[model samples]
Target: MANIDSTAAIHSHQSWIGIVQIITAATCWGTLGIFSTYLNQMGFSGWQVTILRIVTAAVIVLAMLPTLWPQLMKLSARQWFGLAMQSIVGVLGMSVCYFFAVSYVGAGPAVALLYTAPVFSLLFSKFLLSESITRKSIALAFMAVFGVGLTMLGEQAEVNWGILLGLASGMCYSLYGVLGKRAMHDAHPAPLVFFTSVVISACGLLLLPETYQTYTQLLTLPLSTWGYVLGLSLLGTVVPFGLYMKALEKLPASRASVFTIFEPLTAIALAMILLHQALSWIQYLGVTLILLAALLNAVVNGTTTRVPRWLKRRQTV
Candidate 1:
């Protein structure tokens, strides 16, 4: 009986640790908005800053390549293909859009727009992951759509290309999770991260030639600015990214998505404190609804998890 109790205790502790890792990852993600906004003010374009981040992260991973080489080599061709897809759609696509959104819209609305990822995730999963599109899932998606509409009614809301960009970023983010889950099954996170960084960096060079001017401008930044760059690369990008990938190993993406609320909340708090940004009550309500929809969907999904046991099982297969 003592052994049984001890075993259960160990499992419980492990579960909590995974939850904490996820929350910590989300918090780290929240900081990216603050950093991006700050950097933008410091004279970096959203496009430049986004590219710089992935490039910096890629350099960091390149330093570790010798150590990660073996694990990376073990990846099958299909696995590499999946990682490539994840790199294009998830890292580059999402960050570029979100940062531009932050630069265009205020951080508050940008984060609100970013949170719409869950609804996008739900839809993407049905098509990409072959997950069931039950009535409950559809209902949650509609709620999120309504929340997005309300978000557009926020104080700082502008019906501009930036708004469209934010939605695009959110949709790309959902693809990241869906693609990562599909591609990264049973794979170690470190090598995957490394590969993603490299791909994204190469893609930036190939696809975004205008970023050359941005890179040239980077050379003139003061020493203090470098500190922010390092923090953004290491803390906001790599560390949180690694933590998030690790968390996915332990928890289903559904439950993990619930904890991601900490990201926008943290982003909003930091935006207010560091950036002195705020939204009207109506916009806040919109953010609340978006978050609530995500929470409710996760809960509804959890309850119905047993019903669509095949969906969960298929993920493992």
Candidate 2:
């Protein structure tokens, strides 16, 4: 009984640590738009910013390749293919779409659109993974969709291309998550993320004709601009990713995902305070509804026989 008590205490401590890690990650992710916007002010296009971020992150990850070498070699050919697909479709595709969404609409709306990934993830899980969808899931789905509509309509008087791109970004982001889970099943998170970064950088290389000019342009930019790039690479990509993986070690994926609601909230608050962006009251309502739906989805999906009774009781409350 004493040993059991000790084990329970350890587990509880780990759970709290996981919560802190995920919240930290979400907070960092929220700052992504601000960093990307600064890069744009340095005369980099969304695509250029995306490429630079990937390349910088890849270089940093490559420095640790020797340490990850043993685990990297353990990947089967099938897993390699899965990771490659995830990198192309998930990382590259999502980054391009999301950054462009930010450039077009602004940070707050773009991040809000990206938050729709949970809705897309639910649909993908139901269809591709054959996961059972409960009535609660269905309700949440509609609520999220309605929230998206309100957010888009509240943006401007006329509809623009950014809205579609934001939705596309959400879809690609969801695809990445679903496929990444399968690809990283037996792999270490560090090496998997490293390889994905490499793939994204490789794809960036293929766009050299357009991005080459940016290299010279980069040399002309101020030191502060370079600092933003480094921040985006380290703070936006590596540090947050590491924290997220650490959180996943102790938290269920669903609960960890719930913590991501902080991303949009942080983005919205920062955009208003720092960027002087304001949203319509309807848009604010829409953000609230979407966040509520995401929270409900996370709680409902997290329910399992293995869940702690305390967590289950909280869900009931």
Candidate 3:
């Protein structure tokens, strides 16, 4: 019984650490669009900005190879393959899509779309992971979706293909989240990140158009642009990813995702500040609903009366 108590304590400590890491990750992701928009204003095409973000993140992560080299050398062939795929789809695939989504669809709507991940997470967990969901989770989902709708209020020009892009981002991110959970379950975050960085960097290279014409344009982008890109790559991509993985390793998929509310809130705040965007009373009401949704999921489910078995199962699987 003493040993059992000790193990439980250790797990609890790890879970709390994971929560801290996830919060850090969410804060970093929240800043992504704000920084990227700055770079966009400096004449970097969306693709160019995306490439810079990925390449920079890749370089930074790869720089750790000297220390990670021994571990890489000893990795099994299957692990190497997994890392390679993770790099391609997990890092680059998702980043490119999300960046483009932000650039084309605008930050608010893009984030709204990305919020669909929890919905998908709930679904996938139910079917794949055999996790249960609760009524509170359903309420939370409705709240989040309602918040997204409110965020999208008053767009003069609707996003052309914005829905598709947002959905794609959400789906890809869900895949990244689930696969990442699986990967981190048995591997260190470093190698997983390294491979993801490399994959994304390579994807950036492939998508880069020949129009860049000269290395000077590529390397000599304006200082502000560089700063924005650097911030996006380092804080937005590298840092959040690392922290997210740290969080994932310690928490269940559904539980870890509750923290994502910070992403849209960050985007909304930045949009208001940078773009001087304003929300109507109705929109504000929507925001209230969203918050209510989060509270329903995080607090109500845990402490209140027991949730329905079906809903509980829905949350887990």
Candidate 4:
């Protein structure tokens, strides 16, 4: 009917908007390395940087809490627990691993390794969400794994802990997406983001006992360093995350994961231009393969609408 057609049209439009929002978010996230590097140069440890960045973002998001309080108050204890776990494990855990990975291996490779998140996401979607995994998904997974191998091979003779940390970060990041997809069904994006930020900040505090010393050091930091932290918090963390959560409300986590390819691409480009870091040709090829696999996976998964009968029954339990 006409109403059905109108609803379809609206959904199509929203889908496009979601795509734009996620891509924009990925682009902003790509700059994380640059800001992180700057913070490192200012003598901030990875943990210190993570805490500062997250705390700043928490403050920014908390400013909106007054308006969001009504919706937040409506969440049940179970929903609150779900969001807390998502924030602690997904956001806080991922950030710690990722920032340390960046510290060890530099931004470009760290981001490249983090792109493996899509592969993890695919698997999580299969097992956790009970989404169907086609033969093509399996094929693309192999391709992406091969690409990861190529990237590691291109790293030369050095033993880098960053690779492991990056992979862990990717896995954690995928878990975040998967859990967040579930949480989104019960809450609005703004309140969800605010509470997650609060959890991250709280966890950061618990992890670092010398928080007062770090705050004291902050007083002596140059204005430029302060600006970088603010930029990292607002642009890199809050804005991108808010946009990404909004996007997730409109797109499946699997399809939304593909758009994150913009993250590494932007990071690689920025690394080369700003930091003057260059990857070997082989590594470039590897990055290309990874991206292609992500696109292919998105194409394969996006075409389906039917859930398996077993998954349907599982949902009821």
Candidate 5:
């Protein structure tokens, strides 16, 4: 029994390490937006930007195939299909919509709208997972929404179709996050990411138009653009998510979700640094409120509590 307890304690410590890894991953993922703007300024089409991101990231994943192939071969068809869907929703769908929305509108409002993910995640948990709806969740949702509105600061009356696109992207990403929790079960995180990258890359390469005439343009891209794109693909996509799954293995979905508030915060800070986009006092206050709400929600749904739906589903399975 003493030996058993010792092993359990060691496992617990490892799990904490995983939590830290995921937070680091989330922060890196947030910086992708800043890079996207640079890509846009260089006259790259949205599809071109998406293709490079997926293809480059996929190459990194495929490089690990010697170690990853055995796990891929062992997966059930259902699991493989689920992983494919994760790629579609989480990578392809999220990227296509987000880039277009950012282009159509602007990054500040685009990000504010996209931060609606947590509220939608809670809703999906209630509907799909059959988790209980709590007053605390509702309050957090309200606070988050309000923060978005406050950030807009009387600009709500100027809403347009681009705003709708941003909201749709947020909704899609929310579902992606909720579904990812289940689809990732019993899978190797690195391979899962690799497979997702491959699928998204293949789809983009096949579907999106590639102009060979301007293909040489890519080679001549300014050093800064090359640096940003590489940064986006490496730090933004590969390394961060590689760490996120490790952290998710240790942390609860709800708790892990809270750390994502940093995603927008990082983007905001980067914008200020790279673009010198100044935030109004009202916008800063709104950001603070949203961050506070996220913290409150995380505290209220501590890691110890079993997500009601996951608990019930585990029993049924």
Candidate 6:
């Protein structure tokens, strides 16, 4: 029947559309460095920026609660627990670490450092998802780590919180992927992310003392500050997240991962153009190595899904 066909079509996968959606999502994610760095320059501390971003995301999601309720209701106990852990370790942890990473190290290196996520994911997947590790996974992980080391090796006048925090963010991001995938059984990502953002905002508030005086300074903030926050939430976070989910619904995760290399590339380009952050030649080579390893790892992971014992990494902004 035409009616049945229409309903099926609504749920059908369109590969090309998914590809476009993913590319767009990754590009949007690339803006994270620019927004976060600008906010930091406006005198917000790393944790304050983290709190503000999640608070914005939470408020936006709250406005959509009616639509998300159905999905929220569908979450099981196990899923709920998974989401809670994800909120703490993934959302909250990554946000604070990444904001500080960008603030301290500049955008390009911070973005490059975030590439370490896949390496951490490969390790986490084994324990959390019960995934098997392969020799290829080990090799690719080592390559990624070597690249990661290169990203951090540069002139430092003092202790570099950026590198440590960036690596921590990557670990948290890895945790997010494994936990989110497990929590996501039949549940929409919108609702899962909504819940996670809410938890992040709550945790952020509990640390308000870190920014209580900072808020006094923010009462007179320029209107553009609000715009930056809005852009950070809508462009860098929400839109990309929604787009990536849509893409995943229609495309293979491997191809999606490949396209997402655009995220780091975009970040580096934007940083160089707008923020005037430039990496050394060695660091550029490091970024290239990490990206190539990730791409190959994605292919190997996808092709050997049911055969070889390898791990996979799924990233988000």
The lDDT of each candidate is: 0.79, 0.79, 0.66, 0.79, 0.70, 0.78
* Candidate 2 per-residue lDDT over residues 1-317, each given as its tens digit: 99999999999999999999999999988888888888887788888888777777777777676777787778778777777777877787888898888888888888888878878987886665555667778888899899888887784613577888888899998888777655544444755655664655556565677656666688897888888888877888888888998888998887898888888888888889988878889988877887888888888878731433433465698
TM-score of each: 0.88, 0.89, 0.72, 0.85, 0.81, 0.86
Q: Cα miss at 7, model 2 (Å)?
A: 2.6
Model 3 TM-score relative to the real fold: 0.72
Query: Candidate 2, overall lDDT?
Result: 0.79
Mind giving the per-residue lDDT tens digits that candidate 4 earns over 113-189? 77777789878877877777677778888888888777777754134788788888888888887787667555447
- Cand. 6 TM to true fold: 0.86
- Candidate 5 has its poorest 10 consecutive residues by lDDT at 207-216
Runs in model 2 lying further than 4 Å from the true structure: 155-158, 185-190, 197-207, 304-317
Local error of candidate 4 at 170, Å?
0.4
User: What TM-score, to 2 decimals, does candidate 4 have?
Assistant: 0.85
Once fitted onto the true fold, the runs of candidate 1 whose alpha carbons sit more than 4 angstroms away are: 74-79, 185-194, 206-212, 248-252, 306-317
Between 2 and 6, whose lDDT is larger?
2
Q: Write the per-residue lDDT of candidate 3 for residues 1-317, one digit (tens) a residue.
A: 99999999999999999888877788788887777677767666666666777666766777666776676677687776666665666566666677777777667656666666666666765664455777767767877776657655644324356556666777677666555554554465645455554654565475556324322575676566667767887888777877886787898656776776777788878877896656666655655665556545655534543343444665697
TM-score of 1: 0.88
**Model 6 off-target regions past 4 Å?**
1-13, 74-78, 156-159, 185-190, 193-216, 307-317
Residue 37 accuracy (lDDT) in model 6: 92
Residue runs of model 4 more than 4 Å from their true location after superposition? 1-20, 155-159, 185-194, 197-207, 245-258, 305-317
Error of 3 at 53 (Å): 0.7
Point out where model 3 deviates above 4 Å.
1-22, 127-139, 146-153, 157-159, 185-216, 242-260, 284-317
Cα RMSD of all models vs. native, in order, equals: 3.0, 5.6, 5.9, 3.4, 3.8, 5.3
Error of 3 at 3 (Å): 16
